[model samples]
Target: MRPVFRLLSDELIERIISQARDILCDLGMEIHNDGVLSMLSDHGASVDSEKMHVYFTADIIDKALETAPDSVKLFDVMGRQTHDLTDHNVYFTPGSAAINILDPLSGEIRKPLTADYVEYAKLVSRLDNIASQSTAFIPSDVHEKISDSYRLFLSLLYCEKPVVTGAFTIDAFNVMKDLQLAVRGSADALKEKPLTIFSCCPTAPLKWSDVTSQNLVDCAKHFIPVEYISMPLSGFMAPVTLVGSLVQHTAETLSGVVLSQLTQPGTPIIYGGSPAAFDIRFETTPMGAVETQMMDCAYNEIGKYLNLPTQAYIALSDAKKLDAQAGLETSMGATLAALAGINNISGPGMLDFESCQSLEKLVVDNEICGMTLRLARGIEPKEDFPAIPIFEELLREKHLLIANHTRKHLRDEHYFPGRVIDRANSSRWEEEGSLTIGDRAKSEIARLQGEYEPSGLSGDILAEMTRLMRAEAARFGMARLPHEDL
Candidate 1:
């Protein structure tokens, strides 16, 4: 773990604490749904439906935080890798829930398709820094051929990295099971180390959709780690005040933890959210705004106050095009999230309010993630700090001592540049056609794909996946598999 900067000053933290205490004591949260209202009422919270306020004592909030796990392990499908979540580093991914694909060549947004999903997965798999592969986007056209779960199936087959997935429907739950079976090779393997699956439940005063709630319960019953996503929009879904928003988020996430723990005690659950404010003038959720940044920072504080592992939404932008604004927003958001010690930071390759995905942006965001991780690690002191003697010896010695011990140490300490990021002069750049960042990123992606080899699955397992996929295709009444051979 690295030392994190306290985003909130001591006075600010105290103020937040005082505000939270006030909210719990006075203005309380609203619980519109009966189940949630009953749960709160059973606890120490006082529910007033007419006033739309639910008050809780400090003890209840403390209990919820105490219940959450400090760490979680996300398993790789091949059973080859498990990302230990205890390390407080920022992890990046391409994008999530992108309905449109930005054409790398033309820069035009188009409805996503199955081919796009496969290609996106392959692109994500080739990147070294992307720690986990997410179903990058929801293909708009796959609805007719296969259910929404087709993305999960494609991600499992095409992605070799650890996966982050969820079930959108009951059929999708079955698809998740089949996908898990395909990855683990048997039901017994699943029982041994079930793959990590994160499911989101909408925050109150709205009710959790039946489909998403059932999926979370099912994932818990199966012992899969579930990340309860609480996306509360301040001034809209939640109260306008910051502390009010935090309480609402905390309450909703605690509700999710309670359900998961009740279904199966000690099931791993993370306190996660993508909360932000609804811009009053535009009536749009601004992901890159300072308000969004503050919201994430404050929510993170609430998560930490509970002493649980935390996750936050950052590294995303609302920029309509990739330019300086995009760079600034993405860089700042990602930097803050990393410094805040968020376990898993999403929204790397995302843009245009997260409605579009871009390959170029993914590579850029990945480099930023690398830089953020390096920043978090800070600098370690060299065991022997006395380099003055070596410098003195070199200064006395005449010409440059290139092979000196000090020189050797200097070379060992530096991070070398790669093909994508250039450290060249203007003349050298002109000779190379003054390539744009996107052009360089495309070359890098091509280079990686050319050199990359898929992690081999057993021939028997491969054949089984193929057979199951074909059967699934047949059941869906599709004439052919999405890919002739996955």
Candidate 2:
């Protein structure tokens, strides 16, 4: 069995779900979309039309949970299955929607350009540890209106991996969906083999913005997979206690499940969140705090309890630079999220409260992801029951270097990190100039970029995507998209 971590007992999980149900029935949620409100009203939910509030009964919640799938399957651009988001299986992905990127040479944070985004996509396509590529950071060169679909377009063009992305506006969703259809060749094919998981977030204190609510509805209609990101700030937007915050998270996420199921039964959705621990003194929400990590693990347990695939925005740091604090917080969060078996772990390469992306940090976190994946595999008996024979052979030979058993199991049993991790001894370290993690990461980045080849998508598909992007860009007065051949 895989190693497991839980912060809430069976009784506690049941109580939390019960309280969440009570909150929905009694307190209700304010949904800003009129169509969603009307749909909920049609489906037996009590609707306060004047107040824009929708109260769900227990039966409706039960039906929603029953209809939602227990797991979601993801495929790469070429229609190869990449992830089965079920059970205790875990996959790591870089965090999404950062506005700035950390420059490797100068070690300074600045707005990213199209070139920066291209390099990021190429580098992530080469990283084996990261299961999917996210729209990691936004490029300032593009029109602000097309930022959402533009990032998706760039990622799809340069990388073949499935994307973890989101939409910023209701209109952008159509363009983004069109881009996916262009790659998959048809709407039915795109639906049959999903190439992306869009993230839809609900506001804290039980609210859904117009854009996000509409995005959820659109995703449900198209048979696209989505992950609900409910961000509840403990002690501020939510109750101070972790359980209280979890109740709020559950209620908020459950409300989204209801919305999606009501739109279309059996719509794929992951029970995911990005809630943070609110720090009173600084009046800031810290994603790296121990409390935040704890809340992430606990909510994952609740998701599993409800028999749904899980996700969390843990394993990321809030530090501004690649320092000891960055490593400490990121490593701890990644380890915990892995042990908890979150279906899609999103936080690697994120910094400064999820506003910045660091290429160097991303390479380092790739190693962390490797180690955590090995940890989650747990120790299993692999031809070791007959230990006397192996030990006798070892005693006779004085070493197992050339042993057949040794050669076969070595790679599977041990996780050898890449150059980003300093595994050299003192003498070897000095001989290699004692490079810091950042220096090694920089070298790794250069090497990967040198190794990155074309994603091999057809020229016609590429042209169609560019045409769609150009049309969208022209609407915002953008004459040309930066870094494009056109």
Candidate 3:
């Protein structure tokens, strides 16, 4: 049996859902988009036009839940399926939309450029444990208007893995969608084999802004899967208690589900969020806080209870650097998230409360992810049920070094981590020069940069993607896109 972690029981989850429904029915949510308000109103939800508030009934919530897909499949640029987001399956991805990156050489955080993003994509393409790549950071070299699509463009050009990305504006969605079509060859083919998952966030305390609400509608219209990023800061924008924060999260996410389903029934969505536990003393929201990890695991239970796939921004740190705090928080969160069976775990390489990305942290976290995934697999009988034979051979041979069973099961039963994890003896380690984790990670990054290969997309497809990006860049007053080699 796989290892399982649960924070809420069946009764508690039911009560949480009940209370959330009551909130949607009574407190309601303020939707800033008039189009969404009209759509909900037409669909029989209670909408107040002037106030732009819409109330959802139990019937509406149930209908939305019924129509939303239980699983979302993701494919790479080659149309090869990468993830089947269902059951207790877990996948790791880099945390997204960081405004800054941790500079490896300077040991400081600063704005990233186009080359930084390209290196990031190349590194993620080589990370074995990270199942997908995110538009990890914003490159300041591009204009603000095209920043969203520009990241997506670079990801598609540099990596073959499926992307976890989003658009900041309604217009950017069209460009991002066109980039995917350029690779998939048609709208239907793109829909049939989704190349990316967009993250649509809702504001805290049960509200949806105009841009995010429209993004939800647009994604549904185009058959793109979305993960609702509900960020409710506890004791600040949300309630002081974990239960209260969950109620707010559920209300916000359920409202998104209703909107997406109404826009297009059977639209895929992951019941996801990035809620944090508030520290009153420091006046900060810590994703590594035990309460935050508990909430993430608890919400996954809620999502599974409703029979939908789930995602979380757990397994990352609030620390500014790749120090002990970063390792402690990131590893703990990753362990809990994996045991809880989060379908899409989006947090690795993220730091400083999700505002910064670190390549060094990413390589280290890849090892952490590998360990957690192994733990999630648990221990099962692997054709050794009749163990007497193996033990008898061990006694006779004095070792199992040359045993067939040992040779057959070695790779499957053990996870041999990369050079980042040290397993050498003191003498050997001293002989080779004792490198710190940071040093090993930097070496791994450089090695990956050298070993990186082109994405192998056809020349025609590459030209089309470039043409689309150039057109969007021109609109934002950029005469030449940075990183022409990309």
Candidate 4:
């Protein structure tokens, strides 16, 4: 059997699901969106329009679960399969919609511009461990109305990989779909092999605003895959116990699934979250805590049990500085999530409790991702073990690298060495300037930035994307899109 781990037993999982159902059926959720309230009410769900509390029946959720697809194939711009979101595999990408970029040289956090988004896209496309790219940071220089579209447009222009992104407004989301159509040549063509995954999240205490619900609704209507990120802060927004937090997460995600499928049966939806343990001392959401990783595996267990694709915020650290703590936390969090078989793991390159993004940290996290995947693969023993014969064969060679046994299996059996990880002796290390991991990481992203070449968009598609941006800008009383190239 393939390797996997879990925290909830079959009975325990059933109970959690039962409690989630009770939470929805009993307490219900506050729906701020009139359209979403109507959509649920028109279906079998009960809606209280005056109080805006909508209660979903277990039957509606069960139906949604039955109709949701078990696997989704996402493709790169070149039309190659990038990731298949299934229980057996995992994919890593950076966190989306970050507003600040940490400068590698100065160690200063600053607002990102359009050029910065292009650079971030290029960096992600070159990282082998990142299966896809996100609109990593929002550019502050652009008009508030068009910033979302601008970031995605740059990602589409530069990232050769599949994209993980979202929309802030319904209008922006429509433009995103238009951009997808422009890239794939037609609407039907875009659906054939999707090049992007859209995400939307509920406000943790069982609240759904119009934008969040509408994003899922739009995704369902367009046949686009959507993921619900249900973030609950334990001890603050949710009950302090881990089980209670899991129940809250389950309820919010299941609600999204039901609403999406109710809008369009057979719409693809992912059950995922970045549930946090509210740090009482600091009043912060520590993304790197042991409880956070534990929660990662736990929610994944529930999602996989339901045969739904899973995602979580792992492969990250809350360290304000990129130091040993960052490496230690990142290594542990990412490995646990990978072993748990999450499909799409985000939060790489995030720091300061995910309020900041660092390209240098991204370089380091890329290496962390590689090693974690290697660990996840586990050992492959093709034949029965004979300890005596193995020992005798090893005794024949003073150095194993010269042995045929070593020459044949070494590359596949061992992780390819990481450049940032220090494995050299003191003398050799001192000869190399004794650079720290962060120092080496800074150099790495700098080198990549120097040599990276972004894949270009087709002329026709590029023109269409420009036109969409310009028209969106016109809504804000601007004549043309900012940073437009003719």
Task: Report backbone clashes per prediction.
Answer: 0, 0, 0, 0
Model 2: per-residue Cα lDDT over 1-486, one tens digit each: 789988889899999999999999999999999999999988899999899998999988999999999989999888899999998889999999999999998988999989999999999999989999999999898888898889999999999999999999999999999999999999889888898999999999999999999999999998899999999999999999999999999999999999999899998999999999998999889999999999999999999999999999998999999888899999999999999999999999999999999999999999999999999999998889879999998999999998888999999999999989998999999999989888999999999989998788899999999999999999999888886852
Cα-based lDDT for every prediction: 0.69, 0.93, 0.93, 0.83
Over 4 Å off, model 4: 383-398, 402-405, 478-486
lDDT of 4 by residue, 1-486 (tens): 456767779888889888998999888999888888998888778999999899988788888889998888898877788889996698998977788888777888898877677778878877888899987788887788778877888788877898888888877898889888888887787878888888899998999888888888898888888888999899999989999999999899888888888988987778888899999999999889988788878988888888999888877888877877878888888888888998999988887777778888888889889888887788778432665665676777645566666777777778775566778999999999999988888778777777787576677777887787778778888785546641
TM-score of 1: 0.85
Give the TM-score of each candidate: 0.85, 0.99, 0.99, 0.95
The pairs that clash in candidate 3 are none
RMSD of each: 4.0, 1.0, 0.9, 2.1
* lDDT value for model 4: 0.83
Model 4 residue 244 lDDT score? 93
Stretches of model 1 off by over 4 angstroms after superposition: 9-67, 144-147, 186-188, 191-194, 204-206, 392-413, 466-476
For residue 87, give model 2's deviation from the true position in Å: 0.7
